[model samples]
Target: MIGRIRGMFILGLCSASALAAGTGYQPPFHPDQLKGPPAGRPNEVLVLGSPHLSGMPDTFAPAQLEPLLERLAAWKPEAIAVEAVSGLQCDYMRRNPARYADSVSSYCVDTGPAQAATGLDVPAANAEAERLLAQWPATPSAAQRRRLAAVWLAAGERNSAVVQWLRLPAEQRIAADGMTDALVAFLDKRLQRRDESVLVAATLAARLGLERVWAVDDHTADSPTPKEVEKAAADAITKAWDNPYSKARAAADIPLYANVAQPDGLLAIYRAYNAPESAMQTYRSDFGAALVEPSPQAFGRNYVGYWETRNLRMVANIRDVVGQTPGMRLLAIVGASHKPYYEAYLNLMHDVQLVDAEDVLR
Candidate 1:
C-alpha cells in the first residue's frame, strides 16, 4: 500500500481534506500506477540515531533524555531493537570478562550473585523486572525496592537498574542491589555511560509492557585489523572527520546534544539525522573514508566490506523479525553511525517501509 500521512499539514480543512481524500486531487498520476498491482505488505520501520551515551563527558546528564524518550514512546512501536547484541549481557562478560571487568566489578555487584540469590536466569530475571515495574507499589518499602534492583542487576541490566532507580523518588534511590554506598555511587555513574541509550529503550519497553527489547546489532563482519593497517585506518578516519563537511556537521550536531534539554533541541537533531542527505554523510565518514588508501593496499575495501556486511546482517535480523509478524511497527535505536546504514539496507527489503523518522521525531 502507498504510505499516507495523517494529522499533519492542517493548513485549511476544506482544501486540505478534499486534496487528501485522493478523489479531487488527481495530481500527476504515474504510468506505473496502472502498469502493476501492489507489492508486499508494508512494515513500518524507524531507525533512530543516538549518540553513544557512555562517551558523553561528565557534563552530559542522563535526566535530559526523559522528554525525548517520552516523545518516542508516543510512537507506540510494537517491536523495538537496540544496538546491544542479543542475549544476556553476562554472556559477553563470561566470554571476555577482561573486556568488561571494570564495569562488572564496579556496578554488576558480585556477578551471578543475583542469579544465586534468586535462582533466576537472564530471561527469568527480565520477567521479574517487568513484573516489578508493572506492579510497583505506590510507596514501595526499602526491601521491595532492593529486590527489584537486585533482579535487574542479576539480568546484567545495570541500565535497567538505573531506569528503575530513576523512576523512584530521590530519597528512595539508595543502594539496593546488595545495598552498599559504593555500589550506589557506581550505579549512578553507570547511568552516565553508553548504556544510557539501552536504559531509554528498556524504560520505553517497560512503559509499553513489551516483554523484551530485540538486539539486532551484528559484529561478525568485523575482521581483526592488523596493527599497521589499524594505525593508518585510524588516521584516515580522523582526517575524514576533519574534512570541511564533517567539521561543519559536527559543529552543528554538538550544539544539539549540548542543548538537548531545550524544546525541540533533540527533535531538530533527529530530523537532520533522518533526512536523505544524512546517508551521504555516513558514506563519506565511513565507506568513503577508506578511499584515501594508497595504491596496492585494499585496506579501504576491507573497511567498506566490514561496514556493508555489518549493516546487511543487521537489516536481515530486522527483516526476520518483521517477517514473523506482518504489519509490525519496528523501531531500531542505534548509534548515529549506524542509522543511515540501517535505513539504506532496510529500505530495499520489499516488505519493509522506512518510516520518515523526522515525521515521528517531530
Candidate 2:
C-alpha cells in the first residue's frame, strides 16, 4: 500500500491534572486515536474535477491543456476513469449498436464507416482490437499500427485511434477515420475538445504506457419525474444557483478560467476546489438546499436522492474496475460537481485511500 497511512494506533488517555489546569482547553487528539474498521488492501484514488470541454465557450483554446496533461502524465496512474458510461463505446455499441448508435454517432466517430473499413462488425472489431493490443510488441511494425488504428476506430475509440496513429510512421498514418495528418493535429482540429475526459484520460494513459481507460459514470439512478414536479425541481435548483453565495462562487471561477492556459495557474484553482472545505460547500449548497425546501411534494429532495444514488453507483463501478489489485493508484476525471461526492463515497470504501488531488496536481 504505497499511500496508506502507516503508524501505530495509540490511545490518548485523559489526565485529571490537564483537565483541572484549563477551563476551556481540550487535550490534543491524533488520527490514530479514532477506532475504525479493519484495514484492508489500499487503493489510492485521485479524483480530478474537470470542465466539459465540448461545451467550452468560443474563447477557450486547446493549447491551454498541454501543460496540465504533461503534469498529469508525470503522476503515472495505473488506472484512469472518465465521466462516461462504461462499455458504451467498446462493449455496448458492439452488442447493441441500434440502441447506442445515435449517441456514438453524435459524440464520437461514426461506427458504420469504421466497421465497413475494417471489414468486421463492432464486436468482432473490438475482440480483434483487444487481441492486437495484447499481442503488440514493444516496437510494432507500421502495418500493425495501422491495424490497431483501424480496430480502435471500428470500436468507436477515437482516442485510442489517435494513440495508434501517433505510433505509426508518418507515411503509414493516413486520413482514415477523418484523422487528419497526425494525432496532435486531429486532436487540435477534428476533436476540437481537448478537455474531454476520454481524450485527456486516453492520451494520458497512452503516455504512461497503459492499455485502457475506465468509464465509471452511471445514470441509471436518474428518476423519472412528472412534468410538473420536474419543472418545480428545476426552478428550485435555478433559484439556489442564483443566490448571492452561489453567485460569488461562480464569480470566483473567473480567475480560474482566465488561467486555463497555464498549468501552475490551473493547478492552483484545482487544488483550492479539491479541498475538504470545498466539498463542505458543495454539500451545503447542493444537498442542504434540497433538504430545506418546505414543499410537501419533496421535489428538491427527489433530485438530491437521485444525485446521491448516482454517486453511490458510480463509486461501486470504480471499485469493480479497481478489483483486487492492491497498491494500485487510480485517477478519475469527472465533472466538478461530482468530485466531492466521489471523494466522500470512495473514502467509505474499506480498501480505498482517497488521495488529495492537490498532491498530484502539484
Candidate 3:
C-alpha cells in the first residue's frame, strides 16, 4: 500500500514549506514552555506520538501524515530514527527499495535481541518489524538480501552457513518461495491487532529514505488482557465525549469538524477529553483500573501519567541521540496531546528548533 511515488510527492510539498518559512515570523511561548534542549542546535529531532487514527476519525486522519513526513525531510536530517524495532526496519527496507541509503536507529525498551544493549525491553516493536518484513518481497541486491538472512539466522555455525549460502547468486540460494510464503503467514498474524502507530511510523520511515528506524518500548513478559483494557479505555473516552460539559464545549466551538483555529481551542478539547482534573472522573478511573488490572500501572500511574511519561521519554531520548548524530532531524508524528508537551520541551533546549504543530496543521 505504501509506494515510493506517493512518498516523493509528499516530500515535494514539504520542500515548499521550508522555502516559504525563510522570511521568519517568530512566535512566543510561556516560560514553562521554554524548557528542554538548548537553543540553536543544528541537529533537529522530532518526536511524534499519535493516537490510534482508525479509532479517532474525528481527531486524526491518515492524509495529515504526508505533511509531517515532508516537514521532517525538509529539515534534511542525517538519519530519521523511528520508534520501531530493527527487525521492522530490515523488513521495510527489503520490501520498499529506495535510491539512497539512510541511517535509522530504534531504541528497544523491551526484552528483545537488543535488550542487553539498550535496556529498553520493548518486544512489540520487534514482533511488528518481523511481520512487516514478511509481507514485503526481498530486495534485488544479493548482498542486501544476505544481510536480511543473517538477521533471521540463530547465533551458531549453521546460521553462518545459511548466511553464506544466501550470499550466492539468485540461482545458488535455496528457493525463496518457501521462506517468502512463511513470512507472509507471519505478517497475517501480526496485522490482526490493528495498531495505527506502527503503520504511521513505518510509512514515514519508508517515505523518508531513512536507512534504519529504531523501535523503543519496554517488553513485558505477562500477556495483559489488552482487549479488556482497550474496551474500558474506549468506554471512558466515549463517556467523556458524551458528557454535558464536553457537549457544551463542543457546541461553543463552531464547525465541530473544522480544523482547530487557535492552539487554545485544541488544548481546551484535549483538556476536556484527557485533563488530569475534570468532572467526568470515570474516564480516568477506568483508565487507571485498566492499567492496574493488566500490569500494575508499570506503563503509568494513571492515563495522564502514561501520556506524560511516554511523551517526556521520547523528548529525552531524541535529545540524547540527536546530539550525537550531527545533521539528523527527527519529526515525531504523535497525538495531539503530545504536541503541548513537545512544544514545552523543545523550547527549553537552547539550540533545538521548535516547529509549532498549529503552524503545520493550518
Candidate 4:
C-alpha cells in the first residue's frame, strides 16, 4: 500500500518545534547518570515516529507534546527525518513561522498557530522558513539557501530531481519551480480526495507491515491484586451485571452486542449511564488504584519484555530488507506511544543509527 502524503507541508510546520525540542534538549538524567546499552551488538538506526500532535482535534493535543519533545531532543540523534516530501514547502514553513501558521490554519480547521500563538498551539518552525522566504526577492534568502542545501545533502545529488533543478541555468530554475508547484498541487488534490483512515492505514503498512505494527498495551496484562480483583468482580456483578437498568448484563459474552436485542439494549443503557465526565472519573480512580502497588520491578520487567520482543521482530524485518538491498534506510511511521520504547531499544543495537526528529524539522 503506497500512502499518499496529505498535509505534508502542514505536518512539517507542526512538527518543527517538537522535533527540535527532541534534539539538544536536556533531560532529567545526565549521560553519566545512566547505564549504556549492553556491549557487543551491531549499531542500528532507530527513529521514534509520532503523528502530528498539533493538528489532531481532540484525542491528543499539541500542548501535551511539550515535555515529550524536550525529552526527545535531549537524547541528540544523528539526523531527524519527517514524513514530509517537499523540501520547498518545509523550507517555506521554516523561514516564515507566521505564514506557516496561516497556511496550516487555512488547511486544517480549528488548528495551527494562527488560532493561538502561545501555549500548546505555538506556531510551527516552518513559519520561520516561510517568513525567511518572503524576505528574498526573486532570490532565496540565506536561510532558504541553507534549507535548499540541506535538502540537497539529505536527498543526495546523484539522481535527485532537486539536484537536477539546481544544475539548470538561473532563468530555467524559475520554470522548474513552477513545474514542482504544479506536481505538488496534483498530488495534494489526489490526497484530499482519499479517505483519511485508509490513508493513515496505508501509510503505516508502507512504513511498517501489519506484523511489525503491534497494538501497545500500557496497562498491566497480569491479573490484578486480590483486593482489586475482588473489587472488579463485585463491580462486574453489581454495577454491570445485576443492575435493573443494565440490559446487556446477561448478554455480555454475545458476539452481536450491537445487533442482539438484549445486548444492544444493554449497550445503550451503559452508554447513557457512562457519560464522558463520569467515565473519565471512573477511569482515573481505577488508574490511581492500580498505581498504588508501586512496583518498578514489575513495570520494568513488563516494559523490557515487550520491547525485547518488538526489537527482535524489527531486527528480523530489517535483516530481510538489508539482505535484498543493502544500505537502504527503512523508515517506520508509528504512533507516539511506541517512540520511547523503540528509541531505547534501537539505541542498544549496533547496526542502527537513530535519526534525530529535530534535524528533519529544521
| C-alpha lDDT of residue 142 in model 3 | 51
Comparing 1 with 3 on lDDT, the higher-scoring candidate is 1
Q: Please provide, for model 1 over 197-307, each residue's C-alpha lDDT reduced to its tens digit, 9 standing for 90 to 100.
A: 456686677577554567676544333345455556555445544666667677777877776666656556666777778778766755565545442344444455556
Give the total clashing residue pairs for model 4: 38
- Most accurate candidate by TM-score: 2
RMSD of 1: 13.3
- Candidates ranked by TM-score, best first? 2, 1, 3, 4
Q: Mind sharing the TM-score for model 1?
A: 0.65
Model 4 ranges off by over 4 Å: 1-48, 52-55, 58-316, 319-324
- Over the stretch 1-362, how does candidate 3's per-residue lDDT look in tens digits? 01101112211222212334365776675554544454344655444434444454355444544554564455554444343323333333333334212211122111233332223222343443355456645443554443333333211111212323323454534324223433323333333333433344544444554423443321111112244355444444344335454455446435423543333343333334333233234333333343333322222223434444554665665666566654456665444434556556755775566554333333
* Candidate 3, superposed: residue stretches over 4 Å from native: 1-41, 47-51, 56-146, 149-180, 187-199, 217-306
> Candidate 2 — what's its lDDT?
0.62
Cα-based lDDT for every prediction: 0.62, 0.62, 0.39, 0.32
lDDT of 3 at 324: 66
> How well is each residue in 309-330 modelled by candidate 4, as lDDT tens digits?
5444443444444334334344
Q: What is the number of residue pairs that collide in model 3?
A: 50
Model 2 lDDT per residue over 1-362, tens place? 10010100011112222224447765685443442443554677888887667755565665666666877887778988887664344355434554444334433445666666677666687788778866778877666666777676666566666566544566766654433234335433544444565457776776787756666776443222444455555666555445555666678788877766664565566666776677767666666665555454554455555667768888888988776466688998887778988987777676677777777666
Better of 2 and 3 by lDDT: 2
Which of 3 and 4 is the better model by TM-score? 3
Give the lowest summed-lDDT range of ten residues in model 1: 1-10
